[model samples]
Target: MHDTERMNSGEIRAGIGLALVFAFRMLGMFMVLPVLATYGMDLADATPALIGLAIGAYGLTQAVLQIPFGMLSDRIGRRPVIYAGLLVFAAGSALAAGADSIWGVIAGRVLQGAGAISAAVMALLSDLTREQHRTKAMAMIGMSIGLSFAVAMVVGPLLTRAFGLSGLFWVTAGMALLGIVLVVALVPKGTGALQHRESVVAGQAIRSTLRNGDLLRLDFGILALHAILMASFVALPLALVERGGLPREEHWWVYLTALLVGFFGMVPFIIYAEKKRRMKRVLGAAVAVLLFCELFFWQFGNSLTMLVIGAVIFFTAFNLLEASLPSLVSKVAPAGGKGTAMGVYATTQFLGAALGGILGGWLYQQGGLGGVFVGCALLCALWLVIAVTMREPPYVTSLRLPLSPTALRDAGLIQRLLAAPGVADAMVVAEEAALYIKVDTQKLDRTSLERLIESAPAMC
Candidate 1:
């Protein structure tokens, strides 16, 4: 493997551009969550079920379209898919802005979700970055998402108050347009054909991803996490207003406080997990914290202090779990199956969000806020049990090897590569002309590996 350098100016520019693009689009989506439950009630023919559906409709389309959009990007190119997705997203925002009915809003949200460009965007990022710096680039995107969500939680209500819900949707549309401009004007163009195996999906990898028990547990964990998040919002806004005596516009203050505190609180634990090699322990504790927060909300939701405390705990645990899950997935996935593993993880996440909305709305309609809390708590409990089986994520990194077709087919060569010290796993895909390897950096025998590769018949 070549020793990749630190990110250069162009790489930094591309990473920031892509991060902002992702952040802006996510802001458009998340800006509705904090106040939508109460505000959306004004829509014609709105009911709990329909409102929940409207909130979650995007996930349904997003979940269904993610992989296909990713695969399409591989064939046609990333920028085109991204542009089309933003346009669709903008169209959805426009439709929602014009809608007077909840069903219309739902339709628009679904279209917004149908603009599934996350995979394409990530693939594009992978295309432009070096392997060593790829994680940092991806982390920038992740941080953008976290920051966007936090900012949206605070900004969404203020926007709603000033311009009304329709106006907010218009702003979302504008954000999507801005995202398009960024993609065209700022994001760098990659040379040559799309060639990132680490971030591209393969059909053959799916069965193996499914069969990996540890990876399955992590997927289920994300599903439960997002489900609880969507469901909580379905009731949280109402609880803040009716029980806590906070008005709609003031909701941002609470969210701002909780998010700030939770984000900071989560950082130390994440650092501890990484430094101490206790990722599984930290992850399990975070799930347990989530369960406790749900139960606490159920019992003491009416009190302002409890609401604030629960929000703090919920977001803290949420941030911790959210950050850890992806890292765990990367480690647990088979060497060549990161993309397939992530695709499945993402699908489960969206499905969970959709289910949460429906379940929360149904519970609220049937038995109010308390019922919603109880239902979510039960779900978390189930997740905790499953989470217990999740093994510690391997401390490893992925390396891509350029292997010639002939060398790839050489059984002895493949065996020798696998037997190399520090190589945890290796997968050679002849069609892609690459060998994917998982290596523990501290233990990798670079000299020996280099000698073997140099002695090989041809360069890929």
Candidate 2:
């Protein structure tokens, strides 16, 4: 492989370091998801609804502040924002660790969500990586989050069983501190922040991004997916212990088994979707699977065998949808608008989590586990409808290349760029001296693009 196509040592270090930082923070947040409903009742004045609120409170603040934090990093620099966010996260964890009531845990969780550093981290990663390697860097962060959630699922129950909820919070706080250390000691400091529109949200693009019908569909899809996930967990732990006849202490194995099965099971489907260009069909099928899982749970929840089977099926669908949504967002987002579209998608996802927590708790309070499963089934049904209706997404990848001053001045730059092999769309931003394009990678002739850039002035 050419040097441009491969990540160098510096890029590798930055990608790994940033991914670890992201994982630590996400692990802290996710560690409470599994154990909170079961262990939280011991807190003073705890109710099912309140427990659900505590489970999802972080998402509320995260949804509200994520975009602003990304914009803030553009002003004050990435590391400073990251440092502040991590400190706040650690403080929230510490506060939760000492809380004696559900309300206190909710407060701590809200504060935890306030840390919101995802955009800043992505921006920093963009600054540290070359354009050719930026997607890989971003993928590393995505994979880390998935791995952390899986780890948290298994670890949360074990920690709660051993040290109770307070100890788990303390551990979460320690993880935040470790993330701070990684940021300081390992993550490479960029010379300065660059405005990589492909990776960082632009303020002016928000309105148009919102107006996009296709992007809105994707945003709604993520919202429904996470909402279902949070709401399911709201009742799943209880179902496992109360209905499945499993001991609370052994809950980790159940999650461990289901998640392992789910992860491996989704791999081939993901390959098929991407390789065969069958994203729409696969997405709809996954949503339909989720609906089936919920119905199965609702009908046969009392049987341990049925619960395990439903869980395996649910996770498989959940993992597949979770993996697919962001890729769809990337494919469907308009040229130069990917970052903003993603911002909206992420915000909607968090809001869904918050809504799911509240909705699950209320349903569980009113009608028990049956109601929770029914509610999720309804959500899946709606999502499946939306998925099936979505237009086929363009099979293309985003690319950013530095434009020479002469190239920026050339009147026909876009026309010539578009005429290049595999270039589906191209835009040149004079202010940034950058060229952003959507290209079909399979057909993209990099050598042709390079030669075009070399003779851009002559082409005009």
- The global C-alpha lDDT for each of the candidates, from Candidate 1 onward, is 0.88, 0.89
Off by over 4 Å in 2: 1-5
* Per-candidate total of colliding backbone pairs: 0, 0
Q: What's the residue-level lDDT of 416 in candidate 1?
A: 80
What would the per-residue lDDT of candidate 2 be over residues 319-403, giving only the tens digit for each residue? Answer: 9999999999998887788888898898999999999988888889988999999999999999888878899888998777788
How do the residues 345-367 of candidate 1 rate in per-residue lDDT, one tens digit apiece?
99899888888888888888998
The stretch of ten residues in a row with the least summed lDDT in candidate 1 is 451-460
Best model number under TM-score: 2
Judged by lDDT against the true structure, how good is candidate 1? 0.88
* lDDT of prediction 2: 0.89
